[model samples]
Structures are given as C-alpha cells and as structure tokens.
Target: MTAPEPYAPAPQPAADDGPTSLVRAAIWVAIGALIAAALVCVVWVLIGGQNGIVGRAFLTILLLVGFAGATILDAHLAPRRPAWFALASMGVWIATLLIGAVMIWLPERYSWGGFSRFVQFLFIVLILQLVLLHVRLYLKAFQRYDTTFTRAVAIVTIILVVALAALLIVPLMLGEYLWFPDIYWRVTVAVAILAAVGTAIIPLVNVLFAPKKPRAAAPYPTPYAVAPVAPQLAAPSAPVADPASVAAPQELLPWPTYVDGATPLPMLPDGSPDWGAYYTGYPTPGAHVFGAPEPTAPQTDAAHPASSGYEGFPPPPPLPPRP
Candidate 1:
C-alpha cells in the first residue's frame, strides 16, 4: 500500500487595522481648507466687514474644519459602523454653542465679567481635548505600522504638540495675571501653522510608504489518486497419495519449540510456524561445538525391549543396575 502525504499548516489572515482612511481624510481636509480660505477672502471683500470679523471667522472655520476632518478620518478607520466620532463632534459643538450663549446672557443680565472667564476656560478645555485626540490617533498609527519612518513622524508630531501646548498655556497663564506678552499672539500663530502643516504631511508620507499586500498561496490537491492493485497468484492444490503405494510419513522429534530468553516465533497468515524465520533466528543444538557427534539411534537389549522399541530393534543385553 502507498503512504499518505504530509500535512501543512494553514496561513493566517492579515490584520486590517491601519490608518489609510485617516490619511486620505487628512488630504481631503487640507484641500478643503485651502478652498475655504480663498472663499473667505472673497466673502470679506464683498461684505466689506471689519478686518477683525473676517479674521475671527476664518480662524473659527479653519479650526472647525480641522476637527471635523479628524472626526471623519477616525470614524472611517474604526472597525465598527455608526461613526461614534461624528456623534461626539456634533455633541461637543452643540454644547459649546449653548454654553457660550448662556455665558453671554449671564454676563449681560448680572453685569459680571467673571462669567467671561468661564467661557475662556471652556474654550481652553476644548482645544486641549482636540490636541489630545490628534496625539492619540497619531500614536495609534505609529504603533500599528511600527516602521522607522512612522516612529520618526510620531516623535516629531509629539514634540510639535508639546510646543503648541506650551505656547497656548503660557499665554493663558500670563493673561490670568494681567501680564500679556507683546509676542504672545505671534508665537501662538507660528506654532499653530507649524502643527497644522506637520499634521497634513504625516498622513501623506504614511500613505506613500505603506506596505504592499502579499499574494495568496496555491491550494493543496483534492481527491488523491487511488493506489494501483497488485496482481496475485492462486496457490496450487496438493495431490492425494495412493493408500497402498505411499509410504507412511515419519514422525518428528518432540523438542522444545522455544528456548529460555528467546522470543516466540512469528506465524504466517495460514497460522503455521514459519521455518524460514526459525532457522534464521536462534542457534540449533551442536551448532557451536566443533566436530560434535551426530545424534545416534538408541541401543537395543533382549532384557529391555520397550527401551529399544523406538528404533525398531530386537532385544539385546540390558544395562546393569547402579549400586
């Protein structure tokens, strides 16, 4: 019979947890921001509003677009549906608007400027949250890809985030004590621009250097071919001997089939002792003794006929008894 083939282990599926979608979203957001900036300039010219109004509107829209783009990217990259990112962003925006209105109404009704501090605090918290969120997303991407480029990018992003945080917090601290620095706004604007540029560039670089997918291996063969049949010869039947012409079969000596410390002989399919195996195995009597005498027939004696009967001998002199 033919032997069976060896078994091979199955290959595992690749993980689908990369930030490709986020990278694409960031690219789109950058393009949209550029377009929005141009449109804002046109609107400012047409409405002829105060320069402050245009500046504030442009900055607010830019921040909103950045946050919205990030939210969309996160939702697309996430494993599940329902886009929790979109929902969270919407909730935060609505809450901020409502709180700002309440703060404005309270200050006007009670003639208190302290309520303005609350509005500033809320804005600071929101900015901090957005910064943290971006940092977290970038860190996650770095971990997932685990490449040299990604590591460098992650480090750069983290450093920029730290610098931006310092710029923002330092100004706020100074403002709280009524000691605003002359270059505070300039430093803040410079850091913000640098961070935004870096954020936009990171995704583009990641997408460019992303790993390619491996091709699938060929499958094993099905329904293995059947083993070829061997031709068998039929055993010949033994001829029956004539009763009167045939001589009687000789009887074999009654010797031990097994010896001490020897293994039992194996049998054939027909349940007969395999003599070929027996001869090839254990040694026979007198096999090791050189010039050993062959077995002789037993001597016969007239007084002990029974002892000589095995050799078909007539009686002869018997052996004397021991003293």
Candidate 2:
C-alpha cells in the first residue's frame, strides 16, 4: 500500500451575515436621546420649569412611550426586515419631536422640582433601553467590522468621551469663563454640537469603512518541516566485539547413582564402617580376654536342679584375699 498522507489543520468557519444598519441607527438615536435629556436636566435646573402639569403632560409620557415603542420595534424587527423597523422607528421619532413641541408651546404650571424629577425618570428609562437595545446593536455591528475600522472607531469614541466628561465638569470652571459669558456659552454649545455629530457619525463611518470580505488566515507549516530528523554526523556502523576476550567453555560432569534400598554413608579416615555404641556386648577384640562359658538357665525341674548344682555339682571357688 502507498504511504498515508500527513495531517493538516482544519479551516475556520466564515460569517455569512452581519448586523444590519437599522440596529446601528438605533444606537445613534438612543445616545442622542440620553445626552439631550442630560443637557435638558442641567438647563431645566438653571432656568427652572413648572412642577405639576408640564412634567407629567410631556416629559414622562414621551419618555415612556419612546422607550417602550423602541423596545417593541427592536423585538419585532430583529427577525424580519430591517426596513420595517426603520419605518416604525421613524414614526416613534416624529411622535417624540411632536411631544417636545407640545411641551414647549402648551401652557402648564412649571415647577422645577417636578420637572427635575420627571427628567430624571425619563433619562433613566431611555438609558436603560439604550443599554439593552442600542448598545447591543452597536456591539453586534462592531463584531462584524474589521480590526482596523474597529480601532479607529474606538479612538474617536474615546476622544468624544473625554469631551463629554469635560462638559459634565464645566460648571466647576465657571469663575474663569464668567467674565466672558458669550465665550463660555459658545464653547459649551460647540462642544455639545460636536458630541451630537460624533454620536451620529460613528455608526455610519464604521458601516461605510469596515471591510466587507472575511480575511483568510495564514496557512500552517507543512508536514516536511515538522518531521522527525537525524542529526548530521559520522554515518552509523555495525557494532562488533573481539571473540578472543569472550568467556571460556565449561565442562559438564556426570552425577553418581545410588544402590537400591541402601544409603551410602561418608567413609572414616581408616576406611572402615562406624557402627554406633548400642551393640556393647561385642568384644573390643585386641584389648579384652574371654573366660569360660557361664551356665544357661534351666527350662525344667531336672534341668534346673543340675543347673543349680544341688547334688553332684562342682564345689564353689574360695574367695580371694582382700587388698
């Protein structure tokens, strides 16, 4: 069989569709509404407003409706065509503007306290909706945009953010700008205008400039590069040993066999058998002398009397002298 091919890295999946422009548009509008509300709050606090009637009549109603309506539209448009959402959003926008107009022209008791409260509530809801729907939309769009465009957008956003923070802290610099009220207001207005324009432009710029094509990543190194390799050195040779230095051959000896029913005892130095001490009656041949045989024990009366020597027996020997 042919050699198997080497393994390769798997390819990355491509994104088919990114987020739509309607979502990006929603983000712009939401930020605009928030900043507008914040400015209105500061302005209202300075200039003051009627408490009961205007607060409830315009600000509260408009804010709730706009936020609620935008959320509903987002939910509906997410799955369907973006154009439908855009058209619906336009209606909400027009309605909000009209509400603003009514608040300005319509007669009411303008209490600063009530107006401030109303503005606070309005700003809260709008900010919430903006976070949920608009910011999410911005994130989705950013995900689709290329790295270069994303970085540019990020830098611009940071600059605008610093400007907004400066505006928020503007009242602290009142003393320096107090002598030239015209210059101070002019600068504040310019900053506000720039911030609004930047808010509007960011999404549009990203949509226009972000790369449309999905970039292909660089290819991986081939198998030939990763292969196990031998070092460049002297060529390998067959291992050999000198036969003369090897161990000498050893001789095999035959074992002795034993006779049937007999055990071989180890030989004594004189080459004789060594019986144990239990057979003591046997003569130790060279050292001891033998005497006459003694009489045997009788088996019958007649034999017994003869053996005992009652009548015609030999006389007994006399005793030896004492020493």
lDDT tens digits, residue span 155-208, model 2:
565455445444433333222223546776677777667655645555776678
What are the models' TM-scores? 0.32, 0.25
Clashes of each: 4, 7
- lDDT for 176 in candidate 1 is 40
Tell me the whole-model lDDT of each prediction, alpha carbons only: 0.49, 0.44
lDDT for residue 10 in candidate 2, whole number 0-100: 68
User: Model 1 — which ten-residue stretch has the worst lDDT?
Assistant: 225-234
Error of 1 at 276 (Å): 67
lDDT of 1 by residue, 14-122 (tens): 8876444544454455456545544654565567544345444554455456546654655564445233444444344433333332232221223344445455746
